[model samples]
Target: MPTSKETSKTATFGVKNIGGINSTEISISPGVTVLTGKNATNRTSFLQAIMAVMGSDRASLKADADEGHVKLDLGDETYTRTLTQAGDTVRAEGDPYLDDPEVADLFAFLLETNEARQAVARGDDLREIIMRPVDTDSIKREIRRLEERKDDIDAELSTIESRQRDLTDLEQRRNSLREEIGEKREELAAKEEEIDQSSRDIEEGRKEQEQFEQKLKELQSTRSSLESIRNKIESQEASISSLKQERNQIQNEIDELPEVPAGDRDQIDAEIDQLRSERQALNSEISNLQSLIQYNEQRLEEEDYEIAQTLAEDTEGGPSDTVTDQLLDDDEGIVCWTCGSNVDRKQIEDTVSRLQDLRRDKAQKRSELKSKIDDIKSEKRAIEEKRNRRQQATRRLEKVEAELDERDSKITALKQERKELTETVETLETEVKELESEDFEGILSLHKEANQLEFEIDSLESDLESVTQEIEEIEELVAQEDTLRDQREQVEDELADKRTKIDQIEADSVEEFNEHMDAILEILEYGNLERIWIERVEKSVREGRKKVERTKFELHIVRTTENGAAYEDTIDHLSESEREVTGLIFALAGYLVHDLHRGVPFMLLDSLEAIDSDRIATLTDYFSDYVEYLVVALLPEDAQALDDSFDRVTSI
Candidate 1:
């Protein structure tokens, strides 16, 4: 139930050309507001006007007007709805209280024709009506999407875990590389010292060895250039190999992606457009059927025989009797409003009943068509996603291949350079050997050892740099492990919610309906009615070629006999008042279960004359406790039964 704080504000409505009302404005405060009038006083029209501003397309335009408008002022927020005739349909526009009013329409509106109320009266599938707002297919699709995301996250975490296992090995390798580099640096320094000593020795022992010393210096410089060229060649070779491997991996990914057909997209789009057009046609047919049924029902219930009398008078050799007299005589039959022929009232009712059934069937078909369109749209989205992924992979593959080609060219150039450097080194060595003598042998050997030590130091430093980079990369991956696990947990939570959402709504609905039904039944005090409850029962049903188990809500009615013995009874045995109360309670259960009072603020009731005036008063009072606004249309006598403190709108 809503609190007083939630219902303290008043709402004002301005309506024009909606339902039977031409134009009117009214202000209603929170709690019970009764619309007291006889039939044809636009009581229902006022309710329709409220519905229009509340974002329901079921509101009808006035028969004489091409456009209708409604405005609702609640608190400081104002909502408006504009209805304009377009071809055979009325299009609604402008901002309203809600963007989508499906839940409110089902649970909060509470009109006589509301599906939830009518479903109980007609003994239709209660579960289907209650679960209509819940899109199981959409829920399943979301679950699948979340599951896929979780799977991807899990795979990445698995890779991260594997990298973490290599962390220790990478650290050890980094330490070893550092030590090796340090040793090589020390050896290179020692060798340089030895070369310096040898050079001093040569300078002191042989003053004429200066020309040989200059040749040896040139040889060592040439050898250093050769070593640098060889290093460049090795680096280029490694880069080319890595780029080729990347290109191959990208190529494989591209190959694995499914190919999108050239014309499939266009064909699917065309089909979807066709389906939408068909759906629109079905909507029009359903609307027309509903209007027809409503008109006929009013004719029957209100005894408005003007049209039927006119038709009967127009027929040749028509009965020279009053239409009222004809209607009162069941044997002679009443004039058929559609054809001017005399037909039984029951026959006309049977036709109307058939029309109602047809409307329901078409409504079901429309729902199915909507689902089909959604399915096709989902398929289109999947196709577009796949095409996007393929395009991205192809672009990446092209870039990698281009890079590989450039590296290959660079490698070829380096190889040529290395060859030239090698030849020059050989020539320099030969020159040094030719200039060699016994006195300079020690100096030459020291220079050779120093060059070897320098090469070894460069190699060790490169290895250390490689090992350090690997360790840093592993550490970064390890850092992402926590984030990945958090993401997986979030996805799992969402997945669980999606998977269990329908079941929870079902269980809650059943529980709410049962609890409210018991209380209302007790309050209404149906003497024979001992209890009324709903059971969630499971049964197997055939779906196309497959058999599946489904849950259904079974309504149970317990009654006491004259002998004071209680027995179970079917819904068929319930009286008119009992049925209407049950329907209203069912709607209330839906209202509470969906928490419509929190958003809708109003519950509208009409055509509830089956229940007695005292019961109507009790019912309205009981319902007023739940919502901010409870507006009910009742006769003047019924209104008298209500509390005097309740607001009464006697005129539109």
Candidate 2:
């Protein structure tokens, strides 16, 4: 058996799928070979077929087929993956690609894989994923130990600083507060002197204001009573006018009611209903008579047929035999079957004639019943017309009656309102009589005096409020000045201490691990991300248990230009090719870190759609030399540019 390196030269994947693929075998032999086809011609499905045989669980078998299966044939040995029970049952034999760390890292690198796409966009995720393929457990443990030690130092410093808090500015703040207190004391004394003078002036003003207010009150009472009497007189006049107008309307309505000729509407309605009942009875009788006529006529026809059959028998038979069959029994009555004692041919014919007459009478009676039904129908129509006219007259009368009732109601309401107006007018006249005898000159003079005192009192109250607020502010400042000064000094000292500790940890083991990743990117020649690195920084909290932002480290992508090292700060600025190349470089670096060891190890990528054709060709040529088995799926145009870089190529 050859080693994996030799066996990897030519590989074939055979698949019998329950889904997109028919039974087919595809071979990828030595060097770059593109599986080219229009979309969904089993191109991607074939690639997935290879993945499935290599222990990739991403085999989407054909829908509703008995069983789906994939086989990987390396000249030395074969690996198989079968999905049974219509793809519901998955059975795999041979090693999963993930069992090999290098293979696992390569699997993670596949752009079709979710893990690779996620790691490429986020810095922390990329850092962990790239490092996953590298042997860095010892370095990681050392970094963890150092971080724990640094945390301990920081914790001890916090406890000591909290216990022995420094307040260097306290003395200065205390002296300043003393000066402020003295100034506020002088301000308070000046305000008190002004308040005392205003109090004496207000006392004299209050006594004068009281006498004026009492005089104004008595005069206002007289004015109120006069206004009320005037308002009532106006309301009463309006009421009298409205009442007269309503009474005239009621008289007009009573004079205009129209007279209608009286008719017994109920009797007409009863007659119309009776006509309808009679019509229904006529129809029922006609239907029964028609049925009887039809039945009897059918029986008459059958009897005539029987008599013709008897006549035919008589014509064929001997006369004597025929006559004997027609005769009655020996002990019969004298007028048997309407025949006399000496039975003759005429008597037999009369029996047949009587039946014919009876049938004719039945038909005549049916015709009579039909005529009666039509007459009843006509009567019903006439009665319905009369009933409609009576209904219209009744509606008109009801409308006229409703109008008369409304007019009568208005007349009664108007009379009641006129009586109320007369009473109101009498009460108003009595009230106006008493208010006609008061003097208002003295009240006018009192109002002017009260207004002047009110102005002076408002000015005094405003000044008192200002002085009271000033005193309260001065006392608060004196109380808080020392505490604020102590807090400021302590915060400044702690911030300075933290800065020193931050400087001390810059050259630690974490930075060294980052240096190794930087070298990997350089090897992969990630042009867009030359100095890309993750940074650790402190975060702020609201004095609670520490809660970090989504991640502790920030992913910084830096691009170097001629001027200096330019920064590509955000993922958005990178082009599609640049971004994909960054992920590709990471996966390749991981592949080398773990060292390739799986049988027929190869790389798979389904995401060349975003990269330009030139870049795709260049990357294809570049990757071909590094791996023995490189199977790429590309569109026709991109595969055309592949040229001699591919050993052999086939389309689906």
Q: Which one is best on lDDT?
A: 1
Per-residue lDDT tens digits for candidate 1, residues 418-439, read 7887887788788778878887
The residue ranges of model 2 lying beyond 4 angstroms of the native Cα positions read: 1-8, 85-109, 122-124, 131-554, 560-565, 597-600
lDDT score, candidate 1:
0.84
In candidate 1 the C-alpha lDDT for residue 299 amounts to 55
Off by over 4 Å in 1: 1-7, 62-69, 82-95, 203-208, 305-345, 560-566
On residues 373-415, what C-alpha lDDT tens digit does candidate 2 reach at each position?
4455555555566556556555655565565566556546555
Give per-model TM-scores: 0.91, 0.37
Query: How many pairs of residues collide in each model?
Result: 0, 2
Q: lDDT, candidate 2, residue 262?
A: 38
- Top model number, TM-score: 1
